[model samples]
Target chain A: MSVLEISELTKSYPVPGGGEPRRVTVVDVPRFVVSAGEQVALEGPSGSGKTTLLHLIAGIVAPTSGRIVVAGHDMTALGEAARDKVRARHIGYVFQTFNLLQGCTALENVAMGMAFGTGVEAGRARELLERVGLADRADFLPRQLSSGQQQRVAVARALANRPALVLADEPTGNLDRRRAREALALMREVCAESGAALLLVSHDHDILSQFGRVETMAAINRAFATADGNSPVETR
Target chain B: MSRVPHHPVALLVRRSLRQHALSSAVTMAAVALAVGLVMSVFSIKDQARNAFTGGTMGFDAVLGARGSPLQLVLNAVFHLETSPGNIPWSLYEEIRRDPRVALAVPFALGDNYHGFRLVGTTEKLFADFEYRKGRRFEVEPGGRMFDPTRREAVVGSYAARRTGLRVGSTFQPFHGLFFDPDTQHEEEFTVVGVLKPTNSPSDRVIWIPIEGVYRMEGHVLRGSGEVYTPSPHEEIPDEHKEVSAVMLKLRSPAAGMALNQTVNRQGTVATLAWPIAQVMADLFERIGWAHRILTLVAYLVVAVAAGTILASITNTINERRREFAILRALGARRRTVFGTIVAEAAALAGLGSLAGYVVYLAIVATAAVIVRAQTGVVLDVLAWHPVLVAAPAGMTLLGALAGVLPAFKAYATDVASNLAPAS
Candidate 1:
């Protein structure tokens, strides 16, 4: 079963200047799917609508026209609040900078993921911290943790509610190469363990080499396909 | 019992408070100060009203030379203001001998030892006057009231403690309402006794025989040295003698009304003030504007405190946009985000109000000491009033109201832009 399904999805923001003839389309995905528990990589250069597509899939922004089904919830059919609920119960987001709340401990950051959805369970938060191998650092704030450790906490928090999908937008973009590799391995393993599909968006070629299956934005986004006229990239 | 888990808003609020500890503390301190001032004003007002209106200091009416009835009560009963003018001793005698009069204590005030007033009256005044309900003047152990015709003085409890005058301490009278070194009388009066604590205005006075005031050398009798007797201890004649005011306790309320009608409405010589508590109440009512201004100033402080919260939080919203957006991306609703800010304001105000009682106690305790020192009125510092409940609730509500504009600003933060990658 597909944890995420997208069809004919596109997003557009108005041109900065006020005019009737305006609105620049950023995302134009023809079709996409990520099966439950699968780990997929999306590779594209910066400003190529890679982030916009991810946001569309996460329902962070409404699609100008199309359907996005996150887990079992029809993202396009829901309001902003309902979309938030979908994001809470199904999709876990990991930002590039590992945006752990500055004041909260690693365990509290994990518990906070559950706070808006199910209620906070301290024992469960501790379990996630332990699973992420930060058991001894449960009480340490994000700043206290190393870059790799902060990413690891972000991974634990993403999987905190055991969501159906984890949307990671360059989760290791701020880390060293070794830390990035380790962070990638940890996120994939954790996503696999929790049976949550992973769609990791990154522009780095070396990072794309690690995934079993990878899809380039040049292929999936018809907006990019039409604009660049580039053939689909390699996929396995 | 199991401890309930904190809600997401509470969790966020708790963590944010820790994150912004300094700004939060400053805002709360401002609120505490405002709340403290407001509570103190209200407490003092209620206590003052109680002190002034609750007991008439055991008198039913005051008869003095024609003037403001309140002035008559002030000088005669409270030993406060100067008597309007001195009524003839003949008028005092007529009131004293009336069947309607249960007891008449005539006061003659013209001197002070330090700041405490010296009131010259008969020993019968101390023996019969009730300072509170069922409470009479009590002399300290091994002491007694002054002799009726001697220059001896009975020091009040507060006077004894303040002036360090005891049963045998002697001090010359300063012959005026205020103490003046140059106007000191030649005759020295010995402290024959000391009265126990009365917690009334009387506790701040020195008592001597009326005849002593009449014979104090500078006090001219009948506009000449009309010697009733060659000896200084002899009685001064009625035509020559004068009393500042007479505090009268009536046999019945009907007698008081009858006297009020005759002396106040019909007679021309003296002013009659009846139902002494009402007279005191009227005095408070006249000065009530000052109390209102104090209360208005307190509320203004509350407004400024609320404004501080608003400005502080609104300023924070600029820095916290990302955090709120991140919360939105985490599945927290807009109202949840809005409630986080509102709840923080209310929490700050609530904490301030709790601390405000500490501030209030400090203020009231200081006022209590000063009042006890000057007027012998004991203020109950820790006494609870309705404003204690209403003030905190009102301030917190005001705090919540203050947070609304900032909460709106926070609520409008777009999740997609704010939660996007920093790179």
Candidate 2:
């Protein structure tokens, strides 16, 4: 069974001008799927709509037209509040900037992921921090940590609720080469151990090659394919 | 760990405030100042009204020569104003013998010791003059009520302390209601007593015998501005004597109406006043506009404080756009973000109002002694007024209203746009 499935997804933003409004198509994907426990990397240059596709799958952004099913829930048919509930119950997001709340500690940042659910799972957060090699740094605030350590904390927070799918958008974007490779390995190892599917976006070919299955935004996004004359790939 | 889990909104607000510690402190201080001003205004107004009304509760009616009834009560009871005119001393005898009269204490004004008023009356003032309900004047230790026949005096506690006059001290009276050393009466009186503190306007007066005033060199009934100096052997006539005003206590509260009507009908002889009613009406009539203006100013200050909170939060929300987006990406609903901002505002107002109330009490505690000494009104620092509750509640509502614009901004934050690498 697929943990995340998308078909005919489209997103366009209205650009206001002196005359009538014009539509700019940002994302146009025909079909995409991530099987349970599979690790897939989506590589795209800037403005290729990789982040927009990730946001659409995570239910963080509404698609213009599509059917998106994440962990058995049809996200496209649900209202915003219900989509938020579905995201909280089944999806985890790790941003490129390691956007930890400034004054909160590592443990608190992790616990905050579960705060919107029924109750905060502090024990689970602590266990996840330990799994991410941040057990000794749980009480350290984001400013106190180095970039690599902050990224590790963000990874721990993303897995705090043990969701079925984890989304990582250039999680190593701020780290040195060695630290980026190490952070990638840590995220993949943690996700595998927790039996969660991983969908990561990166523009680096070296990191893209590390995943078992790699898909290019030019091969998945119809908007990029049409603009660049790159042919779309068939879904596996 | 047994720590209770806080809501996400609460935690976020806590973190946000902690991140912006200086702004939060400044906002809270502004709120505290506004709340303190409002609370002090309400409290002082209540205490002042209480002191003024309570001070006159002992006497039901005041009888003096035809004049403003409020002025008659102010001069006779509170010693706050000069007497309008004097009624003949024979009227005191008639009022004393009236069936409806319970107690009739005569007062003779127009004399001063230093700045304190010098009242001339019989010992009936000490024995029967009720300062508060069921409370009468008592002489302090090592002192006794002065004899009316000799040149003796009884000074109120405040007056004794202020004038440095003890039981054996001698002081001459000034010729008028205000002290003038050049116009001092030649006859001096010995302070035979110091009255205990009564927390009334009477606390600032010196009591002398009515004969002492009449026998003075310049107080004879020769009309206005006349200075009469009789020879040592000359006799002072009884018909020429006068008393400033008479404080009356009716035998039955119902007799007040009839007695007031009777006195007013005396046709230029005298006018009667119900002390409490007349003083209250006069007080509201005279200072009412100022009070309302002050109250409006205080509320405007509170509104400005709310506006300050609104501006502070809205200004910071621009920088917090990404943080709010992060929360939404972590599955927090827009309402959650909205409520977090609103909660932040309410928390500021709540804490600020509480701090302001503490500040107000501190001020009142520090001012209590000075107020009592100056106005004979003791402020109860811990006394609860409705404004104590209403002020904070209003501030909280104002804070919520202040939060609306910022909360809406937070609610409309674009999660995907903020989280994108382009951002």
Candidate 3:
């Protein structure tokens, strides 16, 4: 069964009128799907609505039109509150800049991820941080940690609630090759270990190649990449 | 990505508060100062009232040769100042013998030591007087209870303390109505005893037998050549006798008001006054208006302090926008963020108000000894009712208002716009 299914998804923005009111089309997805337990990469050039698409899936931003079914819930049909509930229950998000809260320690950061849940998913977050090789850095504040360590903390925090779908936007964008590869592999591994599907957005082709499926966004619409990083070839 | 709180928000709040410790301290200090000012005033008033009421516990009313009600009180109850006019010994004898009068103590005042007044009244004056902490005129070592013909004297606690006079100390008291070193008479009297501390006007008095006062005056006015020691059989002349005022204890508390009116109608201008009523009126004038004015000033100060806090917090709201959005994205409700800001405001205000209350207590305590030593008025600092109400009310109100600005900002945060990618 598909973990994420998108059909005829459309999103647009209204440009404030100086002379004329015009709508800017941002994303148009005719069809998309990610099977449970699959690792997928979402790649696009600058201004390709990669972040917007990621935000739309994460329930942080409302899409103009779409039929999005994630983990059996119709995202397009849910209200803001319901979307929040769904996000809290089943979704994990990693930002491009590693938006770690500056005030909390790595462990506390991971722990707080459970605030929206019943309690700290005991051992789950600490286990994830340890898996990311920052277990010793658990007490270090986010600002005190290196960029790589911060990202690991974010990754640990993201998986704190053991969500079913992990959405990462440029998850390794700020790291060197080794750290980037380590972060990507960690995300893919955690997704599989936690029974969640991984969907990552990145501009790096090296990172893109790790995923079995790739989606490239354009101004007019979204297109899927062939496994070899070739042009879009439609699949039924 | 994780849960709300997720360590990030908590970390942020703690670090932010620590980083701005100076600001927090300043706010707290402002609150503390305001609270202290209000607390000191309330404490002093409480102390003053306690001393005043404590000095005259059992008396229902005081009657005198009426002039000023305040003067009557000052003479009959306080015994520290002159009465408006003298009531004849015959009249006092009549009141003392009346069936309606329980006990009448006559007060004669006309002399002083430095500025401290000397009151010569019968032994009944000390016997009838009550004081705080259940104290009375308990004579200590060397102090004498008035022996009418013995010419012995008892000095009040404060007077003895200030002058370092022991019981049996013999010296000629300054015989003038007010202190005059050069004009002190040659008549010598022995201090027989010292009374205990009584935080009242009585604390600074030198109580002599009413007869001693008259005799002392006679010796001075008639000169040594004309005055001689009286024989045990000879009667003191009537022309040399007088009393400043009389303190009347009626048959019952119920008869006090009626008896005071009857005493006032005795073809005399002497005014009768209730000590409690006079004290209430005095308090209204001294504390009521002053306290209201001070409280108004405090409210204004709190308003300004709150504005400064609001400005500081809201000024940082932009920097906190991303933080708010991130928390919201992590499942923080708009109301939650709003509530947090409000809570922060209340916390700051609460701390500041508490500090202010402490400051007030310190000031009152500092002033107590000096006020007592200088003016003989004891100011107590431990009174709690006003402190309890004012500190919390001031802080809560100021803090609530301060938080409203930041909470409103937090509530209005739009997640998508705040987290939007830079253009």
Give the winner by lDDT.
1
Residue B169, model 2: Cα distance from true site in angstroms:
5.0
Ranking by DockQ: 1, 2, 3
Better of 1 and 2 by lDDT: 1
Winning candidate number (DockQ): 1
Candidate 2 per-residue C-alpha lDDT over A87-125 given as tens digits, one digit per residue, 9 for 90 to 100 = 887888888899998878888998988787545877888
- Model 2: per-residue Cα lDDT over B224-297, one tens digit each: 33434445556656556678888888887678778777777645678888655555667766997888998899
DockQ of each: 0.42, 0.40, 0.25
Instruction: Report the error of model 1 at residue B188, Å.
Output: 3.7
Task: Please list the residue runs of candidate 2 whose C-alpha ends up more than 4 Å from where it truly belongs after superposition.
Answer: A14-24, A229-236, B1-5, B54-56, B161-175, B180-192, B215-237, B362-374
Highest TM-score: which candidate? 1
TM-score of each: 0.93, 0.91, 0.82
Encode model 1's per-residue lDDT on B237-342: one tens digit a residue.
5787778888898999999999989998999988998888899899899999999999999999999999988988888898899888778777778888999999
lDDT score at residue A216, model 1, on the 0-100 scale:
86
Model 1 deviation from the true structure expressed as Cα RMSD, one decimal place: 3.5
Poorest 10 consecutive residues by lDDT, candidate 2 chain A: A227-236
Q: Looking at candidate 2, what is the lDDT of residue A201?
A: 94
Q: Say what the RMSD of model 2 is.
A: 3.7
DockQ of predicted candidate 3: 0.25
**Model 3 misplaced stretches (Cα beyond 4 Å):** A121-131, A219-236, B1-16, B36-57, B64-66, B74-91, B110-117, B131-135, B139-194, B197-201, B204-208, B211-239, B275-287, B363-380, B384-394, B420-423
